[model samples]
Target: MMSDCPVVSTKLGKVSGFALAKAKCPEAQQVYGYLAIPFAKPPVGNLRFKPPQSADAWKGTRDGTKYPPGPMQSTRYVEIFAKYVANYRVADENPRYFDEDCLYLNLFTPKTSNKAKLPVLIWFYGGGFSAGSSVGYHGQTICGLQDVVLVVPQYRLNAFGFISFGKNSSCPGNMGLLDQKMAMEWTRDNILAFGGDPNNVTLFGRGSGGISVSSHVLSPMSRGLFHRAISCSGVANCNLVTKENNDVSTGFLLKELGIMDRDPEIILAKLRSLSAKALMEAQEISAEYHENPLQKLDDFVTVVDGKFLSKHPRDLITDGNFAPVPFIIGCNNTEFCGVLADRFPKGFVTGEIGEKQAMDLTKIAWQVADNIPSNKLDEGVGLVKKEMMRYISPDDRYKWSKLPTNVMLDTLILLPGVEQAIAHSDAGNPTYMYYMTQQLRMHHNRAFSKDMTKKPEFCEADHIDDEVFTFGVPFGNGPVAKEMKFTEDEKNLSKQWMSFICNFAKTGNPNTPMSLTNWTSFKRDDQRHLVVKMPLEEGVDLMGERFEFWQNLRAKMATT
Candidate 1:
């Protein structure tokens, strides 16, 4: 049946895609998937730390069914993928996979006829700058649902992608971002052949990838790449920024490899001499700087390089210099709660006064950002506690007082999301915001692995749950859905969510699809955001008092 699919002729060569009959779309005969096309030359040898080059055009048809190897990353991510991720399809089963020559892109088209030029949806994956692959997302069914073309590009990671050495061309940092830019350029030049409209491209991603999309919004180099963006659970102002002169971390890594010199040229040569695996293993930055939450979470992240990113991303967004495009931004309610819940003792959540008092304010506040001063950390924590008190009834204080889940959610996900939405709205671009509230039937934490086959228990909408609904993969159709036995509520919610995203891609406005509820654009004054649940509810002030507390504290934090 797959042999019936047409062969696409690109400038490089002729390649035929596999027919995807499993797609849930009834309008299309079948979706075609063209996998593992090289978008850039391998970043090997001298090209290791430099920006990616154009892929060398080939003479013969390459096998497009098999996914290309992903960028170099630690194998621990594979375990994390199995343990934590909810929607990993068959393509994502490769746990022990990594390579340097992994600059590839996968394209999925719903067009049964080559004459149709559909809108394009390009996805960038997130793994704290260390892990993720384009193969994980089963994009065929998702794209087929709306007859849109989907593109997923692989970029370098960790030491290979983000090891900055003070802004010179030899070892300039942000090579990962440059790789994304190169992929966009390739799409701009070649996507039409795959039946995609280059002008109607939408770039979207979750977590680190979402931050990358926000970074692209601020970068001058990514201006003409895409016309719209959908960033979920990550933003530039969320303290995700790393230091530009990351010499402290890079130098420490170089010294570990017996290269003690501070000279850029010498360090570059030494770095190139080391094997990819060895270099990846040498990514041990000092823990002394753990006070800074960003450094503690992911030190090797995007930086404000002079070329790719000239200024601080938040400053750029505030100054209205970012790409003027429609945006859909949201975050899960309890994103990191269950992940960190066990760290606190049982008495912590039970509101034992002594147990609550035992918890250190400075350490907890540091998790928010390293910039908070010692004098102000306790005060901020006190303010947060007071706000939480108001939300919980006097009878429920014991149940709510333990493990600062609300604090973490507000500091990391909510504050930054709302801030970015406000900034984007102020910059004269239409922005839509939402808070995902539906609890999903999946694992809350990786600790429970007794029966991986039996579906994990239901948990509050945690991080990356939105991706499952957005992609429309195994859940979109197949035996997995039959096995999982999704509820009517789950199916309805996924359909609504996918419809909203598809509508946004087709028309800049998401409100075009009258079948769905009327979604309103966010403004500074109204601050309206759709509370996404089974029956979607609109609210003007989401966590109003808590938001106000943070808004006031941010000014003081800025002054300090």
Candidate 2:
């Protein structure tokens, strides 16, 4: 590995990285990959529960050939979800590699020399804000095909990353977000050495990572760090994205860890002293104790910490107080279906009780406030039920049913996404909205087979389908079964999507040269959004009436 590696000098020291192999791209350029480069000091021992610090400069050349250990987090849902209805899956945590000291990053560059000055695209992976790593995504294809510098950074996770005690909290939380901020600062100051244009940095992410991107836009500390943003299937205003306060779960975790002291100093000391495994287990036990998945989560998630985040992201955006940058916000046709399908069994949706169940599911998906009156709840549920019935047929089974899937899609993803686009556009940013409707031949959630009849009953594109195009991975070359093949249309769609994303990274607009149609900027009055499908077509008023119904109902409820 050392013989053919390329050596580069960073602020810390001189480092060597291996060249990427087998990426399908033009012969003129090759993708160079550097893995597990430390951006911050290892947050262990006394540094636990604290913000990240810059890594110590090394004396000799360091090898950045191998992937580093990821941050400590549970793999419970990942293992189960991987069996059937999931796209991105995390394998069981390897204790040997998993550690608290996981503040690392990876970089991929297509430029042979630092003079190239290509646009830099930074990716943040999403695992419900708990389970994910930079190693999961390889930047070879994205960088090689798009001719941009790609960077993936690792941040702390779960309780270790986001644990705030209370109002006068000892540990100022959002350490994970801070880690990302520091990574951006490092990129802005140092990316010029890696053949990247620091001023043209574009931050893009999926799911929880998208939520993080939106949060960064709303954050004062993250201002001017990134020049553009793309959020796929995530919004900061979504109910599940942020919490009012996490005191209940924080207290629960402390008691489970056998720390009786409520004092912040003592609690911090006890938390820092606990083993990494023990800390993870405490949160896992707390999650299990609160069996209801919809309510308060046991694992730590984002909260409105007064320091990093002053107010709700929606409130901030609505008031025209977020980072002013071009925005691309979108959700898949079936954003939450892959995971939500697991909750309903084979013949569960076949009666009057099924109606009640569907209503309950919609309520949970929207995270409806308890303060809303029962009459308003019934009105809202009735309207949603009417809208969902249009998609559900009588013969459909639980697995094939579109009722619950549509409800989840509208309530969780589409509505929040449009809401965000509206806010950003009104705030004077050039916002582009989209709904991804393409079903790729190769996707992690899709069970592949040559026989078309053997395909699963789910029709809509599942979560993370658009991710394949975003990363420039060809359909046949993905992690799915090898028997499947990519068609001409699939290849064209992938190329077109990649072109749009690369153009967005280069210039804030996604409308580029290759595609036949021009992606128009989002207009609040018409609410036009590009229906991202095989033959990309523009659609007016996406879910317009249905979304308006909910918005009106909400407004009416607010008045009463």
Candidate 3:
């Protein structure tokens, strides 16, 4: 049985994989999965906060059958959110073991020879750079259906992945991103043995993973490693990407860990000496120091390291100092619905919010003025609140609830998406933009409410809705599929979506197959975007007024 397994000789060693069960991917032509192949040496012990090192060659064939343990992270919030709001289970949600040594990758391929020359898609899972794993997403369906090779890499999470102590410190930031870079380099050298075209590689991801894709495009270190890019629901300029001082963040974590040393060498030695569990626990406690609500989303985040990133991503993109590759970027219609529901459950359940609640929410929405001076903060907040209030009627409570949700959707997701698209298109990159409008059938939020009875004026698509379709979850027999029901139309939609994505991966254009509607290139003047739904429709100027409002706000903040 051991000898019967499929084995491929990589640059480092020989690794064996198992044939995917037919039940897992009924539509797949032929998919073989090589799971948990070590791409870099484990980021553990003495190498804890340093950049990833290439894995050493092995003496014999390595077993890659079992899924790797998820990178170390606190899972309390993930479990609650997944079960209640998202209405789906996260694959390998909480494994029996978690570790700092989580730098492995899973490969699914249709051809196992160097001559197959299939296109390759490498995915980075999105957990806001705090919590997520490469375990649950099965690439068998994508590889089998699209005739390509799919790779999902695991990186360090939480403080272990992104801890930094400023310019003079030994611990520069972006360990997670560096881990992804190492994986790409490894793939470039060894994917041909797995029947993949190293030259035709495409990087795609959602949420923070999407942000990572955009970051790679801006980084000098990541140039020439990937050819094309796809970012869903997030980009480098998204509000979720933090602008906090990393030195302050590191100081907070040190305080939480009871370390008072001010010396960089002493701090690095102390941090490296702590156990993974101790570091993770301290990172969680350090959240109290971040006063900004948005900054608290993820305590550890990517920084503009001089080597990996020479300047801010927005400045780099504006100055045309990035890898100009074919890009696909967009977000769901209501990317913040779940967060709204979780935050104001009563308002969502009742379809109404108190006047005070509405005003408080408006102030929170205006926090996007992160650069506004303290002297002008009150004036700016008042101006935004006044404009936002005009959209809501005093007699209607539902309007009150909808106002904040709309503002959040605009600031956090939609505005950033449009800005990134405009930047890429203006710089002469072939860019395609999409807006997902198809709502999931299983979850009934009714515009950010848990109540199924209340029907909103329109259908709303929540965060990760596009990812669900992109990964072909509806048609597969995985944990996500078992939790919910999918209609015949939804299943078919998943197929079409995968086709478009794989087509882009193969040819750098989604419309090459010509089976679906023609997706036009996004232009600076036109600003057209594809409305992703059944019987796909085309439109121009998605949420124009809201986009302009944010633009005006930024302009005013700059002048004041």
Candidate 4:
């Protein structure tokens, strides 16, 4: 099960990575790990905004026992930074990391068997479009037992990765997506040497990574890059910025950057040329931009760029543009309650600043969207803003749960799951859905604030609860994280997820004799949900009546 060879090699040289878990650590002695490994040449200097090129050949052996720093970091989340460094460990002498010259990936195999080409599972980390790395509290045992190739690639993010230069062919954006495409192509060509089956690849990601994977599944440019898809705890939403299209979104950015006139080409060119630090500093002016995930999402995301991405990923999925491959997509039980604990004072049932007032605020909020027809923009951005305000800011934060809870109940939990379920059902793909109800032995209140904590009767299946179990990495080494080891129930859940994923990778269908009992596929007519509940019972429906009401509201929104 252990191998002393690097999974990938090129002209530069043969870098060797050892199986730390299976070879060194007795606790994880059964798990095989290939640490920091390169997939493409470093993107720096002249190659900064360009596509990935080959790295120079190395004459001697390269030691890839550690992960390279990825992209950049911000100062706000000190705790998060500590966790990141801890996960992406480095030698003691070199502490400061985070660079653009990180085009490496780490692939962990349970065992190296040349006789059989094992299934490959590629992972994408989450950090909106701003920041995140492939190394974190990710689990290694499942890959070892499941006998698959676990590939984790480090892609570009934020201004360093996605900002474009006014449609200039030379100044291309979306470098992050390009890097990912190259990694997949690398897997296709070289995975065999690592004892992995190139043809049977499943793209899996959470949060930002989920959105990225979904975009790949829906984009024509990403066709054939991967065979199956799994998007967790993320949406498939995106908006393109332009003079005519994003005046409101751009106006705020321009005002913050001290630009009076809304010049897409001139200002964008100057902004693109600015140092990464300068760009990061200036971007801080628009607080809304940083708070929202989309603004900083890799400088290069799915756009209406005629070449790589012709249309938005969501629209494509809605229009039945899926690859007919198997689909397993789900979101956390609660999403927005992440850092800004839920505190909705009013009922999301009605916007605090009503639709009319929101329309007025929209004019101020969006500085650059002067060209968008008022009625059209109001119907679009304005409406979304009004709804968001209601969800994010409640009239009260303590001793009560109003709009925040209602929004979580109505939108975050149910909508994304049911939508994708219906989409997969229409395409006749076997889509197995999941609801993460298992609360951490600790942090039940920390996630959504003690005030907004659910009743003991009502379990917290909060936004990040799944990450703990899914990755086998503790979020905060709290007493619960340290003491509350995975019990038989948690192990069963993990095994169930593995069974579904492994079977799906092995065959097109994930249905098996040991499937969760009564868990049903999405039915457009019946509208039944196989709610995953405590004690892990199936057919335990969620807030079914409220969900149906919300679903109808969504249908009505589309028609109007």
Candidate 5:
């Protein structure tokens, strides 16, 4: 008999988890879900600079009723980064809850009947190099809908995770990655107790989360940590720097604190003495780093410490020697729309036809951070939006061409998606690609619902659209748009996604019994994607004419 509610006693304590829904796994008995359990000792205060230590065993039955607090994030709403970039909102009253000690993971498990081991999927939330959390994200929805277990963890970000201290053992800026590794190690040790199979684990994420999965793919320390890897929307770019490039950004932040920093130990001690507000205040000086050349706020990146992650992520991917595991990866069609909108509001996205000034430098804020090769910088600066333009047809160009927003989706996002998918495929890894154009608009450009008659300008699948379906966190509190009217087509799309994912999880083949041609694996030289247009069919080239034009232009630029 399939059970809905099940209980498990963990090392920390006895806990109860209720399976919100039922789905058969390799073998199904009963299932339960638990949210917000500490996988490691929180990395706050003195523990901030140190690697993730073990979780101290608990004395009482711990409750996993709700998600734990998210990590110390930006000075804005929980989804401020998304709202700011995507021009959409996914916020709730979940006050931007943060703390350096934030280290939590949510779990969903099928009630196992003896030795039936189910594969696990660990989702890593991504928000540029800036902000994100696992809280409120739906782990149970996916797990219950499909028969796989789901786990999502929260890690430090920005200054906390990316703080660099040059070449010093005392500095552990990459503690964020260490936090993820610790959680994986924790799962290896404890997931079994929750009726999960530790041996078969897949690390997946979208956007920055995708980059995190890529990080693990390339990290030597991350080997054997996961069996399957999937990265969505976040490309090979936008990852951490190598060891040789670790700048003294933490020391600079300390200098902002009016302290002549000595070493990581001294800096951390001094930092710990300061209140959290004060620390955030110091990080604010990055505004100066944004404008000035000298006196730049030091770096805050995943330290390429020889001990932890041994190389820059791109190097590993290029060598065709990443964690040789089953791989699935792709990007969103409109990943850069919101961000480009933020940069060039109105129709400013159109570039110069002959002069070198047609593009907006601010459009690609991420690639500009590194002292990119002057040429690459120029290319990246214009490339994001230019590629977006490539996706619209000649007829549509007249409608969206003049205005930057029209082409923002295709150029900034889809182009990058194709680029990353090609890289993974060329690397001899089994890969998949997707172009999600399902823009969820409640009204005419308004985030919330509007009059029934009005249409929306921001109508295509903007950035982070894919994330919402992947993590089924419904709004129970705070403000949320009334786009809750998911059409039957949308629901069918979601169902297809769920079916495909579950199939992938079970056998590495996304093929459903019903040949849903809407989603297919890409072949080399076949620059096409599962055009997630309303009909959501899969077959061949989409926006082909524009794609060819953009490819030629991009190729022309690459040579120079």
Candidate 6:
């Protein structure tokens, strides 16, 4: 009989965890879960906008069964998008369920002796660093499948997390990243008690979470914390990750909140006094004032603070100053298709957006992707359109309608990911790359099928498609699983995908234990990358023409 509860003793105190239900991890005999383990003290009161403090020692056994409240954030946009656009359910983020003092982690480990020393995988969730929770991603399946320990850590979000008041102020930037660093430190110190090998840990995340993983690789403060890194869809060099003029944004925020003080100390004090809801509201309002299109995507994001990040990630990587760890980086084939579909619903459904509308949207996309000056905007748009038209005929209305999405795929996600991989490989670090082309069953575009009664055969994979399979969602009982009806082949594919991830975490190479295809390591000379889908074929020079077009265009733009 399984024990009603499993107890583990840590440096702080003893804690009790519950056994995972059999349905959650069907293959394993038992898996233990310890939820809501406090890694840092509450960042409230005077500690707001400050680095996380170590958790205080507790006297008695603490209950680690119930989930802690999610980090404070405004979930209105994400909630609407998930429900209406994606036709999917998101983790509940009820206002009452969010709290400012949300610095906790959830851990799952297979049944083993304390000395098992299994590999550790820490997940940093993605929500543009403004909204997300550790509640939805259950670790039971991964832990049970691979004899590994999975941990999900929660960090501060929105204004409370990334708001910076410039240098030498009471509030420096990247408190959210500092929260992640602290959680990593906590895992390093205490994971041994949970049968995990701290020295052999892997940090993996998607979207903004992926950016966090890549940021840690470049951060001097994060060295020696983890052995390997995996960034699924976002990288530090992408347009989404920016070192914006935070002073302007900070000023907007303070002015919105009726605090127009220029003094950092005064600003900090006033911000600390406001309620969490009020600060979040101010962040939402101030975000509208940002003219930079990239900042609109993520106003509160990772910055090159002198302490956490001394220089730009590109310069650091080129100078060989980043952590020398094995890396795996990739993105979905058409990462922005769903975004484009939602943005222009009629165009996608009708499959005819007309040439004028396509060109206009493409111009806007070019502005966002390349930051072309107003005088040179038309020139840049013409260059992009010329190259895009080379692949598709001028009269093909259906393909023309989707031109902007294609531009975003290359300029925003694919190009950045490939550049990072080449840089990492050139810097003498082992690097692996993948291009996820397999369309997920729960893909948002499926909802837009002309025949709503029948399932749509969408071919392109959108953003976060890789994440669904990476977490074994198809086989688990999460909200995503409830919506997706997986076939036997897809379930097997998920199992295979999880094996590759686990194998990488365990040995720093994905093709360990066994693999259907020999996964090749990425090299600058050949630019080899795996085309991840059914059968898993190895491909060389992924998007060679498109990558060259963007690279040459960027070079030309830089010179001009």
Candidate 5, 355: how far from true, in Å? 11
Query: What's the true lDDT of residue 415 in model 5?
Result: 48
- Which stretch of 10 consecutive residues in model 4 shows the poorest summed lDDT? 474-483
Root mean square deviation (Cα) for candidate 2: 3.7
**How many collisions per candidate?**
2, 0, 0, 18, 18, 0
Q: Give all candidate RMSDs, comma-separated.
A: 3.6, 3.7, 3.4, 6.7, 5.7, 3.3
TM-score winner, 1 or 5: 1
Question: Which rank order by lDDT, best down to worst?
Answer: 6, 3, 2, 1, 5, 4
Off by over 4 Å in 5: 1-5, 18-31, 77-95, 110-116, 239-252, 285-288, 292-299, 339-358, 361-428, 443-459, 472-483, 539-560
lDDT of 2: 0.73
Q: Which candidate has the top score in lDDT?
A: 6
Kindly list the per-residue Cα lDDT of model 4 for residues 1-560, writing each as its tens digit: 22554444533456566553431113332444555667778876556667677555666667666667766544443233332122212122122366767788777765555546888888887665566776553335556446677888888865456555434345445677777888888778767767788889998887667767766776677778688887776545433221112233345556677777445456656565666666555544453554333243322344444445554544666888766777776655544333323222232212332444334434322322122343554455534444545434454332122333334434543555566667867787766556665654444433333322232222355544565555433222211212333345655565566656676777755556887744455455655444444455554344455546555544544566
Give the higher-TM-score candidate: 5 or 6: 6
| Candidate 1 collision pairs | 348-402, 349-402
lDDT of each: 0.71, 0.73, 0.76, 0.55, 0.58, 0.76
Give the Å shift of residue 317 in candidate 1: 1.4
Q: TM-score each candidate.
A: 0.89, 0.90, 0.91, 0.75, 0.79, 0.92
Q: Candidate 2: deviation at residue 229, Å?
A: 0.2
lDDT, candidate 1, equals: 0.71
Error of 2 at 520 (Å): 0.8
lDDT value, residue 380 of candidate 4:
53
Q: lDDT tens string, model 3, 397-453?
A: 476676667667777667777888888888888999988888777565333334332
